[model samples]
Target chain A: MKPKLVIPLLIGIAFLLSACAGVGFRSDTSWPGLTSDGDTIYMAFNQAVYAINASNGNLRWSYPAEPERDRTYFAPPAVAEDGTLYVGDFTNGIVALNASTGAIEWGPIQLGEGDGRIVGGSTVTGDLLLVPSGDGRLYARDASDGSAVWTFPAEFNEPLEHPIWSAPVVDGERVFFTSMDHNVYAVDLAQGGQLWATRDLGGAIADSPVVVDSKVLAGTFGNELVALDADRGRKAWIFDAGDWIWGSPAVRDGVAYFGDLAGELHAVDIRSGSEIESWKQSLDSRISASLAISEDRIFVAAESGILFARELSTNEEQWKVPSRGTFDGDLHTDPLVLGDTVIVATNGGDPLLCAFDVENGSERWSFTPGGSDKRCRSG
Target chain B: MNIGEIWDILILNPMINALLYIYDFLGPTLGLAGAFGLAIIVFTILIKVISLPLTIKQQHSTQRTQALQKDPEFLKIQKKYKGDRQKLQEEQMKLYKKKGINPLAGCLPVLISFPIIFGLYGAIIRSLADSPSPLLEFSKHIYSSVSSTIIPLDSQFLWMDLGQPERFPIPALESIPIIGDGIPILAIIVVITSYLQTKLTTPPQPGSQGAGMSQMMGIYMPLLIGYFAYTFAAGLALYFVVSNLFAIGQAVLMNRFKSEPEPAGKKKKKAEEQPKESGVLSLLASTQESMMKLLGIPPKSTTQGSNSSESAKDQSEQSGKKKADAKGS
Candidate 1:
């Protein structure tokens, strides 16, 4: 590495790998996913779902993600265009967040301990949701209000394998979901009809599937890239990375990108499953955080407390920015980049929500949910 | 139970109340009970005492190794044969035999302490469960069996509930902004004081490799810990600030008493460096050179000169007076 080139290279690599590097949030209570509908940005916390202004990071409103009495809340909240936010909680059913206000419009959709995945962000399509759950059922919940639209029973009965591993992917009118049971489902959005299901991709599919055109691209704990046809629910192409792929894959244009536990990020063509660009950057640790994608850029957040931003086209380094603390050991949040500011969250230390100026990689503002030292004094 | 009573059962119970009670049976004046700085002070003292014998052993082993390899000829042989593993091992054993240096002395205590900390953690969890510990089956009884419910075993000095110190009233504090409640000023003071505490206690280590190792800890460790202290329970932060101060005091005392060897000709180098500084005010003129090193850089201003430049104006006056005297003479 040349003297001038090393820092730039490290900076670029760090950004892609930095997002997943937080230690666990202050408690099991944390908002793991942040998503928006242009004007409103919704974050799921331990017991509440917070809505912030997308432009200024201001508090628009906060809705409770969990039951009123129970402490459990959804880790991620999903936003739908019809002004409904689909949120999950461990104890209560998934509640619908009013798009304008951070208020739950109806009683939450309750999940049994078997249905607790009612707390993660699910892909929303019209009135249907292919909801992944901890109880092993991937439910199709009504997006309008908290209603049990339908649920696909798992092939197996084991609890761990049954729990929802990651959020589902929606391609066209079909929804795709992967689970710990090592299965992927492609169900029709309108009728909750099972088009096809593929589960033999080897390891668990904790990494949510990313949809590119007609194919759903998913990485497996099995360390293999399994692509399922959105129309058929059959195998499209599988690229084996020879390491555990714990995080979700990102799809932009026709390239699907993701890294394995072995720390190799791959950019593969969605059509043929052929590797387009493969870049290896060693952070000397494991990565389980999901990959976030913009139109031209791909960002992977690592558990090493570093975020690596890479140019999607070239797979080249762009910038690496570090946070003030370690993200939770498990990287649960997926950051969304809006223009120059990338709104990201870490569960470790005190910082909860941080907006980074994408151009200079400086923090625009830090929004902490009251667990930092700065908040300790009467200040 | 109030926060103090809870903390008393958790952290204070096992370490302070229990330890003091045991010590009391041994003596008449166990005056170490119920002090503000007691927990941080005593635990640090225990760590120092426990590590002393190992520290002495490490010192002797290093000294002995130096003594055996004192001969330049043998050292030259080892350097010459550095690539040969067999030769290195032979040289190492020969030195060990000659100097009686145990190869594995330094790692023994650390390896043993891991289990001790683990056990203590288990005990802390059990105590904090508001239940009895499994190990010292009686520690449950110790908090329960011991008569007295004055502090609720969880009282804290301020907003902190010492018993359950992890959860402070951080949400409430940040809610009260500086403009409205005048708490942000206090928060700023706390951050600065603890940051200063972190800065003073943690000396700068060397090299990027050292920095890499220190990336998660060492210098950054104190800051990270201080950060948690600032945000976490006040009792823990109070414990940490007092602890660092105690550690600094102990380090200073130990350094004065032990006088660890510096560069062999350090005095000569200081004499050499002073002459080199005589002409170069540029090196010390900037604020970058004057301000103390911190984890994050201070707000930078290119226009401001360092204090050394301000002092340079004063020194020039004395020099000018001397020049006048020389001209008069």
Candidate 2:
């Protein structure tokens, strides 16, 4: 190629490829709901909450937690020990409601100074909910009351201009999170103190960290699985994949599993940090949402709104949950796991948080929230 | 200033005025004063024809510089002076001098066209949308106030006005069907024609530039023109369509007469067939001329030669082509 022409052509190809590469691939990955606390099902579809008994595929109680007309929820609710539900809203702030009565606890912990949505739900370590903030800060709220405790402001650490987009993880006293800075940081959960950060995490970390064998495993935008020692925050190992790894990690036994934006399910050994097995799923869109894995099956939500399931051992096709035809607010409201029953929030049309029978992906019941002024009145 | 206001001054006003001027020039010729279709065509053709020299210069320069695309010595210099940008540029200039090529010659024509483009834009803004300023109003008035002895600009052309596209008015619906829609059938047609024109005129900028920018430009420029047509008056859109078609015609015309080099070894056989009596005659009378100084006589006048055969060839070939051509004549 002529240098004059090649110079521009290479530049253009590199630019286009980088842009497209940054955007994760999509296949048949769906997370109808995410797993929280290994049990208690917490799903959000415009703030409707359905408690499905984890042991049985039965709906315990469902309440339509009122949401602002302009706002929507992007992820599932974080459950407190006292049954206080903390969830992020698209237009407003972090909301705390009584889990049982679905009653409002206090004002939603509004993020930032401007008009921006709380992009993702909070992750709780203690009374502090260490949630990723779109305002570019990790916020800690009082677990008892929906009050701000402290904030860990985001910082630039990457040579390239990649931004932080994933959920944060807490390991021991240190909190591990990924940023556009291209580093995985282990910060003190209490004071936002930097314990240790890997300089080369290779792309943004949109996925929340998964702790297994005292090692932090998280997927990055570069489609790599990075394992770091939980206490010291040293790099354990790295596994590069086909595309971006935006979805959060799911750990089972000694095997750590995560889905990439490329719609491929990867199972890596926690000890060696090597790919034990990999399965490709033909998803229509990228899996930006987290993966909800049970003992035998893993559920992934493709950006195309289709919920895909596969047997973990055999990597065989399970069942798929179809999304509503219109208006998908956000699909990564992690599936709620209540033993044998799974509750998921549905996007499109009138949004609702629906419960499904675990053994077979069947709709148990649904609770739609929004367009109401009444705050939950709990006794 | 805000972006909208900046666009209004630079892009909007100029484009409007150009259309309005063209409308006056071709309006009566085609018959309709308000429809303005004929004015648009004439103006478009005029703009393309006027920019012919620039386009040709750009194309010729691009072709001449093709040999510089993958020069090994160029690559060596680029590598040797990788970090030193100034030195790299100096080396590049030296290389261009050696090959008798201008690096910027290709881009200069395109860059020169930007000013005319700005004028056309000014014409588009003032006349079509009727949001006139001192500059645009001055232009419109100046065009209108021409002498009777000179060519008078008019708005009437055929069944349509030079200022307007074909608009179907539904009395029950509203005053005009396309007033607020921001896109009309005529505008879409113009945008599509402009896009095709761009594709035809633009040297296929090698596939490496990614379809993103070019593809984006292809799609986006049309979409942008369409959007403007909907928001602005029809006169500007008509101008765009006319200008694009003119470009297409110009490209075909210019390319048809372009020069090419002969195939290898064909000239050597001819040289052997009609051998010149003298070495100089052989060099000039035939196409055996290699060195630039081979044609220049008076060996004492010429300073130096570099090739192994340069000194011998220069002395022997100095005084021969006249008798050779005379014999042929």
Q: Judging by DockQ against the true structure, name the best candidate.
A: 2
- Over B113-215, each residue of candidate 2 has an lDDT whose tens digit, in order, gives 7656655644443333211111112232233233211111233334323333434334454644445422256676877776766565554445444434655
Model 1, A1-379: lDDT tens digits are 2334544554553342222111111245433567778776777766667788777667877775333666555456777767777777765366676778767677665654432445346777766765677666777766665566666663344333345657777777777777655778777766666788774566556557777777777776556888877777688788977666667777666766777655677777888988864444555445566677766667777655567677777767677666344443334466678777776776543566767777656767666654343321111
**Residue ranges of candidate 2 with Cα displaced over 4 Å:** A1-42, A46-69, A114-116, A145-148, A154-164, A278-286, A303-306, A319-333, A349-354, A366-379, B1-329
True contacts kept of each: 0.00, 0.00
Interface RMSD after interface superposition, each candidate? 18.3, 25.8
The first chain of model 2 has a TM-score of 0.72
Question: What value does the interface RMSD of model 1 take?
Answer: 18.3
Q: What TM-score against the true fold does each predicted structure earn?
A: 0.48, 0.45
Chain B TM-score, candidate 1? 0.46
How far does residue B270 in candidate 1 sit from its true spot (Å)? 92
